[model samples]
Target: MNEKQLEQMKNGKGFIAALDQSGGSTPKALALYGVTEDQYSGEEEMFDLVHDMRTRIITAPAFDSEQIIGAILFEQTMDREIEGLYTADYLYEKKGVVPFLKVDNGLDAEENGVQKMKPIADLEDKLRRANERNIFGTKMRSVIKEPNEEGIKAVVEQQFELGRQIMNAGLVPIIEPEVDINSSNKEKCEEMLKEEILKHLNELNEDDRVMLKLTIPTVANTYTELIEHPNVVRVVALSGGYEIDEANRKLSENNGLIASFSRALTQDLNVNQTDEEFNNKMSATVNSIYQASIT
Candidate 1:
């Protein structure tokens, strides 16, 4: 592991950029960037377009370590090159930001009001590739739609189990069991999810540290205990469909948690914007998120 990168993750002043939209979420992301479905035909072309979008974001003058500490990349993006360097390498060496890779294949159909991650058939190979590319961590997601204790327990267990596998491969894991923000039982479900996560966290050795990405809680500082855990590197909150302003507000209320936002971070950007326009927007976005994270 890169100790310097780990220190930055543990004590950084800014938020993580969730640029890891997969095959399932890529279309929506592109549409938000003003690239409609009709612009790309096949899957290959589709991925290429998305890569271009990511490249534009990474190479932007405002995308350095000033107010952005890390970025999460899709598998395809991890394998691609930017400025004649591997994507992860560019982020770490040139931009002074940590890099993480998204490893889940996607989620299964909902069962017991939860959607567990689909099996990652070759995670070992993927982790090996990530290590080679200088990625410092990994993120996978599962979803909880209700206060079903049984289902929430299963989801948290699955996350920690996969997390251990990633740890064995010498990478930090960001365990994300997202509680559906729109669920009728959103607050109750978050409580249950927290309990389950703590149960599993208590079983780990002190050296077996992990990060967490969760929905912004219904109450401020709901994750204070988790944030203080010795086995937790950091606790971050996902935007979970919140707009940028709302997300920033909620994040500021949580003392120790930071932002790991996707759509909220890129919502103001457009593919056709001039370079100056893009950089200005990025600068504003990064500053807002950084301020919220440090509050």
Candidate 2:
């Protein structure tokens, strides 16, 4: 029997620092933080930057535990040992923050202008690993580009399909279908996205509960219904390349949407800061985001 126990995902009214960048976006993030090719002698040596970045990300929650309730870590950092302590355990035991793992294999180009998350190979193995480690939750992200009703519905359906598997494995799943902010038809796309997501959730039994990480829509308070959905334990927003201030502005317009921001959360921290400076900057940023999440 799978005796792995699941703790309740009590992260409804909270902020999740998103540091789960895959290979394609990691280099750009490193560059923003002043980690450049010059630091490494060769391509094989580049992981050092990622290592340092992960260390900082893991450490930040300790400074502002009240502001961040959870974090979603990349696969590379999920179970990593920092100074002989497991990263997830350190977040929960020391800082009171939950740790979620990013389990998607990344994205693959599909027939439409949109993309799909690559199929998770041997996902059962991954979930078992998370269960063994006592990780709190899991997240998967797929993108929506244009307002094709069929294509958007397909993405939401696939996300929830994977979500059911995650839930059955005893993990809370955050189903993130990120609609591109650059699209000309964003309002139309959001309406379609909302319709399709509700369509699927209505089919699910009462036991099928999940979280949502979405783009901050321009229409004010439109997601109040989604946030209030009984099956939706929480509804969070993604920065999706928006500046942190702008992301906060849109997030504030909706009553219940909080933040699961990746770039926006980490954009301000620099590689050259002293330890004191780094923690101060991180704490300050978290305070700003936390304030936005509640108000």
Candidate 3:
């Protein structure tokens, strides 16, 4: 990513669509879209189908110029280009929507009060490939089901260290510390998450800059300091489990946060709709998300 691309990631209207769920989640999405299972004989085939559909959906005319400034793409889609165009080039080159790749292998089982990201044995290799492909940044996730100080510290520290590695590889990293929305300790967890993130940031050099894709806090606006911090680019918010209206309302309360929503952004679409109907629905959702982002 160049200086201009980096700036696009940091300072856009900041609505990013997350289409990076791993292979395991693809079938569920296909079924929801009413796709037939007879076409694919195995899991790999299923993922291929989903990738083709997802690529087409986002690249359709409806999404081209929406307020969505970036997309977090799964690896399969990233590797497959059309007639010499990177899968995301349609979004980035033509539409100015920067691209980010999901790095972590997903979460391991919870231990010592927090669940950490699954180990990626080839992360350095992966980051190198992503850089070569012109992906603007990377997003990885770790989960916090409850507020445990030791667990929170470990998660934040690990993310920062990995983020440093990513920057060294020449791409920004978006640290995703997600809290279970149903947890009674949501507010406490966010507070601890905030503290640990700040501690790590304070230890980094002045040249370090990264993005955060956090859950919408239980206490809205609690992360304004992060939003305003010099080393932080943009404080992006994940929709977590919130519905569209609720997600929009909660996100609007934060002064500088914007949406990187996945499910919420596509929640109301009817996958069975005709092409014209689908485009109209997709356009409306994009417009709604855009309003929430700018508010």
Best TM-score goes to which candidate? Answer: 1
C-alpha lDDT of all candidate models, in order: 0.93, 0.79, 0.82
From the highest lDDT down, the ranking of the candidates is 1, 3, 2
Candidate 1: tens digits of C-alpha lDDT, residues 111-181: 99999999999999999999999999999999999898789988998999999999999999999999888
Error of 1 at 185 (Å): 0.8
C-alpha lDDT (0 to 100) for residue 198 of candidate 3: 87
> What TM-score would you give candidate 2 relative to the actual structure?
0.92
Pairs of residues clashing in candidate 3: none
- Can you give the lDDT of residue 276 in candidate 3? 86
Give me the runs in candidate 2 sitting further than 4 Å from their true place: 1-13, 41-44, 61-64
RMSD per prediction, one decimal? Answer: 0.7, 2.6, 1.6
TM-score of each: 0.99, 0.92, 0.95
Error of 2 at 281 (Å): 1.3
